[model samples]
Target: MTAVTKIFHDRLQVILDNHVAEVRLDHAERHNCMDVAMIDALLEAQVWLAERVGVRAVVLLGEGESFCSGLDVAAVVSTPERIAWLLQPDATGMTPAQRLALGWRDVGGPVVAALHGHVFGAGLQMALAADIRIVHPEASLALPEIEWGLVADMGVSVSGAALRQDVIHDMMLTGRHLSGEEAVILGLASRLDEDPREGGRELAQSLALRSPRAVAAARRLRREAPAMSERECLERESGLQRNLIGGPEQREATRARLEGRRPRLA
Candidate 1:
């Protein structure tokens, strides 16, 4: 495990279990606000997890009181120097912030976001990328980018397309916050729970019990389900299967099943 640095200490944390990875946004002092460092940390965390060979699922959560309160206002408002710094790109080939919000969609395994408290602006955009969003009753979600004098560049257009047009328009234009219940009713959150963390943990555990290859294939299928044609879907399925068959992980899975033992996957 890498040690959290002061620059990104409040931004993110990663814990890799046997086959499940948990990533927590930890900037409680500022409601887990998104900042340059925080964004970099998030990108790094995802990149790290994607390269790992054993993870079958990922659970994203927030530490302390909230998931995220959106961009760090202080970082933007404090001074011209700070603003410039925040706008600079990272050196690790991290995708742009907008694309970074879509990273969860590209991960091979399922991603479940456990949201609670304030989830606004960029925060909400990040959560929207997850395959499943489980929100606590007290969670509040919104898109305040328009009010902040900016167009939402953080993949909102793509992710929000999953929701009803009117719902997306309402959040973007009005900056209206939605409680967890409201989000569920509006088809934003997948489920509601009293404690998002426990709910997320249970869900991840259940998912981990499944075959890793099956979960990955299901994720790929779900991502293309909304807009892809049957022909395109079949082509994608073929490509993914070609990459998985005889691969180290796939071979281990097959061998384990035949031997009736837990697979020791790479």
Candidate 2:
């Protein structure tokens, strides 16, 4: 018999329980910064969750006060050779930066990111990729890459958060931080919660109870629609709806509704 691979037995604190996966950034001393190692670990976490058949929802959180402060500049500056590898064109063709920002979005299930304290630069980009972002009242978000003479190359332009043009422009230009309350009003965050981690768990529990197939379908459409032309978007929507209309999950959902009971979800 083969030994089962542990989902997370390494750097990050990962827990999969009751169909909900909790993926956290645990380096508080460095303000949860994404050093080269952390970036690779995050991508590994994404792959682990994506391959799991039992996971229904994911909760992303930082173990300490902050979500992630940004990239660990010292890591690259101290050893310039590391930067070469990060920027090197790979067989997969995706830069390390892009993988770090968008890997969570590519997962099969919905992701809820709960933010607190300083969520800056790369951190903000990662949060934008989540299916839902719940932020604490005091959490601060900013794109400070420009201040460091670096472009925000981590999927910022392609993510849905870029739709809010005015907000993006101001934050990008001034390196100013947005509070969680303002983030909600501007649509960057889904809502404000006093205790974001607990809020993330509650949301995850609620999502885990929904039809997993429908949840995945909706997430794919939300992502694909934005990258398509109007006609393509409409056609994709119809095609996806056709696939889901009479599926086992849909029938189960209908039966559950008729019986006035919770659906037997994945």
User: Which numbered prediction scores highest in TM-score against the true structure?
Assistant: 2
Candidate 1 has its poorest 10 consecutive residues by lDDT at 1-10
Q: What value does the lDDT take at residue 78 in candidate 1? A: 68
Report the lDDT tens digits of candidate 1 across residue range 1-266: 33222223447888777567788888889888987778778877777777877677788888989988898866657667755544556674433676558887655578899999999988899999888999997899999888878766677777777788899888888889999999999999999999998899889867876667767787867767668888988888888888888887788788888999877643
lDDT of 2 by residue, 143-176 (tens): 9988988778777777754458898888888889
lDDT of 2: 0.83
Question: Which pairs of residues have clashing backbones in candidate 1?
Answer: none
> Residue 180 error for model 2, in Å?
0.8
TM-score of each: 0.80, 0.91
Per-candidate local distance difference test: 0.79, 0.83
Candidate 1's C-alpha runs over 4 A off are: 1-10, 77-95, 230-266
